[model samples]
Target: MSFSRIAFTVTAFFLTTSALTHAEEGKFTASPGLQLYSLRSQFKLKGVSRTLDTVKSFGIQLVELAGTHEMPIPEFKKELESRGLKAVSAHYPYKRWQTEPDAVAQEAKELGLEYAGCAWADHKSPMDEAQAREIAATFNQAGAALAKVGIKFFYHLHGFEYQPWKKGETLADLIIQETNPEQVKFQMDTLWVVFPGQDPVKLLEKYPNRWDLMHLKDLKQGVATGSLSGQTDVNNDVTLGTGQMNWAAILATAQKVGVKYYFIEDESSSSESQIPKSVKFLQSIRW
Candidate 1:
């Protein structure tokens, strides 16, 4: 072949390869399942088997636990497997586990969870610098305890944590620094991060590999700050794509950080209707 022709062919191949690479990298899926808390009322009405079947019908293949709904471990496992779903993680009260880590670990094992997480704990309000350090130490201790049992732990950040404690450092940052990543990771809630006047993308970028799970929730226009203390009408929870969060950017960053689970936590009164819609929206998303 002529040298010029060969060069042109090589250029075309490179361009095509680059484009394919970009497409694959940008791809995303709404695979992270529901918190079940999103559909608590529906689950109660439909019963566990029926609820899981409904969830599967929405194309959800995974879920995070809210409580076990008082089901025995074996019964819960059967219900989950019956619908071809898996529990990627679970949320339990920290104080409960703090006293009974072993029992908690057993339950997590039965549920087949990779992450056992706690949401919202107090570390004293208007935390001073010293208090912030103490808070970090407390988290580290909790994380270590969970880790000892081969159960991974996560700290689900609520908006109250966005407060600044020292110069150029926030409480969230301190938690990330203090807790060993091997012991504890973060589950970043998009709505919580945004409402606190902090950017989720920046948070993802700031902590490499620190976030493993995410709650794909959105804030309404007049809702209170990101703190869990603020109450918003659960009826307002909307489909994933329709929310105020810039999901494309958020998911893209999440994709970059290798976040494994993305739960659609629609704490809305319209959960039954919204669940299917949210699932369809998630299924429609390419990445």
Candidate 2:
């Protein structure tokens, strides 16, 4: 067979799913949602129309948006609604959440977001006590201001913040204990928490009330940890049930904590193939 034919076959195998059954008809029983960032590449490869149409076809109803593919926010909002997908929440640039909080609230409102947030915080490597405290201050401010407008503000955990701070705790602990519960809620990205060698269930139990949302990501086994770099290869992401995560316990804790939303985030080149399986895996899990 020609090289082109081989490549075509490989691509087809990865993108193919169980046909119209991809919609699964309410299969995802536990907090069903998608993090639009999972399809970041797809949105870039295909325009918003094609990309979201694919998402709609997947039967995903709730989405946590990353960005709008440069379409004006209103247009993007309209497009999502027209396609039957709801933007329950969104992640904006860290600086935007810090500097233009009012604008964040406005955009969240325009998109009909029940929740809005920043996925990362810019800080020094190792995230010193002082820097962690400073970030907590900013989070409190952003959270207070956003909450005033009737939208909940949350900070998404990115592994690196796990650098140990106090004698027994880490910087993440400072953020949780320092930030006002009413003002700043949290969204635990399970893979991020795990990547840094921190236990998501432990953190959830440590500060249950602080977590209002969660990013359900699974990490590949044998990845080195304890580094505070805050970045990694996106391809390391794998299908939910196949990775090195204990989803049954994690989701059980999340449901117990009253988490309001859960989004599957796949930052991999093969997310197209993996996502349908991820959805199926979520449906297969139980207490």
Candidate RMSDs in order: 3.8, 12.6
Per TM-score, the best of the predicted structures is: 2
Q: Report the C-alpha lDDT of model 1 over 189-212, residue by residue, as the tens digit.
A: 887787777889989998968999
TM-score of each: 0.85, 0.87
| Model 2 accuracy (lDDT, Cα) | 0.85
Q: What's the distance in Å from true for residue 171, model 1?
A: 1.0
Report the number of the highest-lDDT candidate. Answer: 2
At residue 251, candidate 2 shows an lDDT of: 84
